[model samples]
Target chain A: MTAPSQSPIYDRVALIGLGLIASSMGHAMKKWGLARSVAGHARTAETRAAALELGFCDEVFETAAEAAKGADLVVLAVPVGNMGALAEEIAPVLKPGATVTDVGSVKQAVIEAVAPHIPNGVNFIPGHPLAGTEHSGPRSGFATLFANRWVLLIPGEAAPDAVAKLRAYWEAMGAFVEEMDAAHHDLVLAVTSHTPHLIAYTMVGVADHLRRVTESEVIKYSAAGFRDFTRIAASDPTMWRDVFLTNREATLDILGRFTEELFMLQRAIRMGDGDMLHDYFTRTRAIRRGIIEAGQDTAAPDFGRSVTGAGE
Target chain B: MTAPSQSPIYDRVALIGLGLIASSMGHAMKKWGLARSVAGHARTAETRAAALELGFCDEVFETAAEAAKGADLVVLAVPVGNMGALAEEIAPVLKPGATVTDVGSVKQAVIEAVAPHIPNGVNFIPGHPLAGTEHSGPRSGFATLFANRWVLLIPGEAAPDAVAKLRAYWEAMGAFVEEMDAAHHDLVLAVTSHTPHLIAYTMVGVADHLRRVTESEVIKYSAAGFRDFTRIAASDPTMWRDVFLTNREATLDILGRFTEELFMLQRAIRMGDGDMLHDYFTRTRAIRRGIIEAGQDTAAPDFGRSVTGAGE
Candidate 1:
């Protein structure tokens, strides 16, 4: 029988990490009553306490297995490098018919690491939410973080009903859900997220190591273009490190292409090839227009950044 | 003589090339009464008409010379490549004791191109405003574009009074003004603006050229990191081309360093060096905090991007 419209989708949901994505999920689930009870586990006592204090979770556990016990759905929200160990830890306690999904940026590695440990009756779906801010941690999340975002699900070997249920849950959290294969999801994310974050980190590192440009000058004059790169680079270090480490092949492939293209532009600059530079830049500009038209980004000047406190 | 608080800084100010910077300056001047009469010139008649219709300028001229004649201050706001030609066109019409400035990105090149064309009694101070958006054109200007933004003035060979007067004018327009030499300005900008922009353009171009990732997917899932690069890459193509061409030496130097560092990061990723990646990412994260502390950028998550219309 179908439940009432206002009824919770799951009797109880377990979140294995109390980072940005998991905390935001907890908030969204609580705001919409998507789950009757939300339980959480974090690596450190401090994070567990923070999650409980934040009130996104009804209860917190010291161990992920304890959190997974009696849960209708278990969400793996840890860094990619820790996914396999966490999955092994929580496997014994996973309830039969419970669906397990992850919120990792990389998909294939997550599938490989988490799938083998899942029980036969339980569903193991790897999912990624294409949404985040530079900030992280339990306190950095809000209910609206995934409101307009896309959540990609990889339902390998999962029952049709299980897949549908997971999709419905994400939809309830204000995200548009799509089905994607793990390998393809990893490649798409490499181009869209992993490679771009690497470039941003590299650029920021370059700025920091510059002896001629003082640290203050780099910070003060960052409004031009460097500030945007810094924002991307400012993302949680451990999480990003795991992303790069686990998604090595795809990230390196994209990075190689990036360097090839960058060298071409560098040559154009050295050769004073204005037409080449102009044409390349014009092509890139068109892509930006496409993004704006797709409503993936705001067309407001400077991402609608307020000018307040800039003068003070 | 000190003018009253409400009085204009200049009797008549001429703005050459009615684009983003010029139109923004016009709006700021009008809003703050920084100038008694604002005159503007654009290469295209449509832009000239738009400037007049936008009401940022009191009058619009078809020729730079006509706009410069009898003006107390003249601003060369054209692209870097056009600065020399524009300066020559307006040189004969510059009034005695008047100060001429530019809003070019590359200072040394602008000085080299425009300095020789300056009339003996007229002051030519090369300046650059560290403010802009992904958009350009006469209509893209706003009164607060320069608010709290830094405007670096290279007041080489200009009289102290002329430099002070121009500083006061910029202050009235809501900008914090600083002075730097032409070579140092070009180098600093290359590190802070030029190199970062080139990298962004290259990243966007790579995304555009990818065969595996569909354009729709790249645009739709851009919220992760690529969207920021698109914003920086969407900046005016012609202006950016001129910047790379004119600031070739410094841009090349910084580009070399950037690639070197990028290769290091790439190698680390290839070797699965998580600690190295984490440390580098953490270091860059600190720089972003510094920028927010310096009031150069907002601390808002994702630049406080609104989630409205994101789902619809």
Candidate 2:
């Protein structure tokens, strides 16, 4: 069911990490009145102070347990590696019948790590918003971050009513919600996100290590194609490290397939096989058109001019 | 030295392929009076008609040789694969004392292919404007395309005066001009553009072939990282195919190094080497910052939002 036009989804919502996703959620909640009061907690005092200054929350807590004490909704918006430990720390203080969800990239590992510690009577759901900028920290978020973007919910054994309420809250906060199985979600994301991100990181790393091409030259001429990889590689390092660790199997599998495909293309290039390269390049072009038609991305060339003010 | 404020650098200029680069040059030349008259030619009648309709040229010719006739400067703006044939066709008509240059992606191959056919007294200078949008065709160009971008000139044996005049013309159109050797230019481009494009094409191809993850699912959830690859993969098939074929040695060499680096990352992932992954990702982020500081790209987190209207 859709959320009501002007009602708060929860009396108190606790954001356990004051990063991009958490802060965006707070802003969205405030903009849509999805929660009556927002509470935030981060390990760093500076982040907690910054969260309070940003005015996305009514109260800021120094500890995850303190944030979860009286909240009806607690969002574990931390890196995947920290989820288990945080779950254990907050387990004793979680309000009875409250819904606890997460915004971790990897699901199965998070569920296994956080599920046992999510005390009885609390609903534990794993979620991931398929939206982000190549930015992190409290200041890097906006209310519209999740607008028209997917927010997948892995309900596990959580109650239907809790799941429905959570879905309504996300929809009110501008996300299009979908129900998904945890394993399948991991595999799909590995193909769409994890493997691609690793590849971007690798390519950028390669450019960095090339001694012959001066770093200045690489950066100056990046608009040709490598700049896009740089953009993706610029994402938060901690979050990505945890992603590869937790989503190990799926990421490795997709990467294996990718290396195989790359070898084929490499062989074609070495042999000067114009027809094969042309055919492969031509095929990929159609997929790009499909993405445009599907409204996932724009048809604009995005030569990094508008983004960087380069051609001005 | 810069050309005088109101004087045209050339009495007549011919662009022998009215595609993105040629059309953009026409616009820039017209904007600044860089040339007194511009004539264009394209293989397709439709492109020639469209070029004439766009009014970027004083006249449009049906053949490359006709376009070259009597022009003081002629630009072979055709694909790398066609440079030899186009050069042969236009050689007989090329004016004496004319400077003939090209905007090919692979410089050495183009120099080898187009150099032999140049008539005596005609200057054959191979050049590449390190700027473009993913969009192709004569209609996809704008006057500001070359602004603040690098235009590398490889003057094999062209006269110094002719090279200086051509450099001034490019500067007049707002490009930072540099002189470089052809083989080196090709190697630099392989690292910066060609290999990155091939990797993008390969990644997109991998996603397309995944049966479990429907094409629509990949398109829907592309923002995680795959969308960037899609944008690069969307580049013109014919142009990219020619680039890989013509820049075979350098492309293969870089691709070899890329695979080796990728294998190391892959091994680190499989071994759950968080330290290694973190270190590598951290280094790449610095290069991205360098690119921003160098005025090559922006630190704007270009979430593909403003360009695509996706998040809006």
Candidate 3:
């Protein structure tokens, strides 16, 4: 690690395929003065201008190669499907000995996509930051978004030194970083994140189709339970679509198990079994306590208000 | 309404059936001096003792008729299934010109069950209070539980004076009083509260059975959408069973519509139609916004904390 006086992690930090994660990284780096200069590149020119106009990145480039030139760290922050192409675009232009990493939710796809293009002199690391808002794109970027959030680092079993340095970089950016195998990461996330999203999507879909009742009534009475699903279902359609498409195997596996369990619960409800409902509801309480103790959430997320004074 | 300093609504109030709602009403009455004394009677002495020990009611009695002796107002707070039996027990002892009300979730059943055995000079006013916690028994009672919540009164046109009096009593207890037809109230509540609870119960039941991947993961990663269902499902199972049994026709009507709508979304997912998924997800966002505007929920509830808070 650098001395406190020389604390900079990167001289020119390049952010490739900017979206909610990438743009937020740029904002965070600038906020903490962790990088000398923050430059970003996206496939869409409109998005490039948005990155610049939003003032999230110091420099915006249309091509990944241009953005990567001379930068010491390049973060791939795109949909998993676009990671390979972005890797190919930046590989030849990245500085020798520079560290390349990513912030995709799924680490396996990210590692497989970006590792092949890493040249002899460069190090490629895969990371998945567990922090995010349902909103996407540059406008949703915030400096403190990743503070206290988990970022899983999967660099295989080969590059200890590079992985250590990337872990320090994430730490500097106000994130808690851990190292795990890409496959295990996928499975754990499938249980925690993907399955939850799928269930939410399904519930929202169910509520959306209920006929006889006017839409106004559903909208009015969502506080009963359906509102929570709406928030999760409102997540970026394109990003979630890519998630289900790319992580199909794990998601489907979990869903199949979930359906079977649901059928059992249905049978109990039909049979007028209150004890069964009581026991399951009671057991789930412990896990929610674990999540809170894990600091995965606050007393409540005060959205649209930026009310962090309670914690501060 | 009695100019703020008039006599209590009931000189001697007898609260039949001690449960969460009854206990809460007892607490609110005690806290603000809304009623002189909350004399309660439960079928079993155990619940009556529990209520007295919890300090939820001022006094406890073993028999409904003994509790109703000389009482100017009687509130039935039992399960809908037992309302008729309790009414029969209390009918002979109630004072002349007494005003009787209930806090059942379903309106029509409460009225039908209690209205029959009413004494010649008594007035029966059916009520439905839309406020409760998942926790049951007297200890769960809190004065503020009904604060800002809706309390619906169904006087069926003829009992306007009694309805108006009950509205004042609820308002004094910090509730917003709404007048709805008994049938219309049941239908709206089935869509708003009943159907949502059933669906949540069903989904959590599903999650519990899917233990291979979803059992633990469902609770841990509940934020994706499933957590909402789990929280709703975690509500008191006995109360819900009573709700379903009492509001059968409306609950079934909404359930049939809900299943049909759910099938449509299932077909879209099976066909991999991104546009349909996006459209439904997007439309649901507006409904959530509307719910928020209706002052139903704070910006966002504590996702993981909600499941735990249900107990608190």
Docking class of 3: acceptable
TM-score, cand. 1 vs. native: 0.93
- Which residue pairs overlap in candidate 3's backbone? A261-B206, A261-B209, A261-B210, A262-B206
Q: Which is the winner by lDDT between candidate 2 and candidate 3? A: 2
lDDT of 3 by residue, B1-312 (tens): 112324576567788888778888887777767777778998787888898887767788878888888887789888776888889988988887778888887888878888889978788888877666656776677877666556777776436676777788888777767676788878777766776666555555445555454443443344434444555565665566667767878776666665555555545555666677567666755555554555545422222222222221
The models' CA-based lDDT, in order, is 0.83, 0.84, 0.68
Of candidates 3 and 2, the better by TM-score: 2
Model 2 TM-score (B-chain only): 0.92
What's the lDDT of the predicted structure labeled candidate 1?
A: 0.83
Retained true contacts (fraction), each candidate: 0.82, 0.74, 0.26
Candidate 2 similarity to native, TM-score? 0.92
Model 2 agreement with the true structure over A7-69: per-residue lDDT tens digits? 898999999999999999998888888898999999999998898898998999888999999
lDDT score, candidate 3: 0.68
Model 2, span B1-312: residue lDDT tens: 223347899999999998888999998888888899999999899998888888889999888899999999999998899999999999999889999999989998998898999989999988999777667899987786776677899987889999999998888877778898998888888888888898989999999888988776787677677777888898888889899899999989888888999899889989999999898888888877777666635532222222421100
lDDT of 1 by residue, A1-312 (tens): 112238788999999999888998899888888999999999899999998888999999989999999999999998899999999998898899999999998888887887888888999988898777777889988886666567899988899998998888887776778897888888888988889888888888888898988997887777678777787788888888999888888988888899999999999999989999999988988998887776635432222222211100
DockQ of every candidate structure = 0.54, 0.52, 0.29
Q: Which stretches of candidate 2 lie over 4 Å from their true place?
A: A1-5, A296-312, B1-5, B296-312
Best by DockQ: 1
Question: Which RMSD values do the candidates have, in order?
Answer: 4.8, 4.3, 5.2
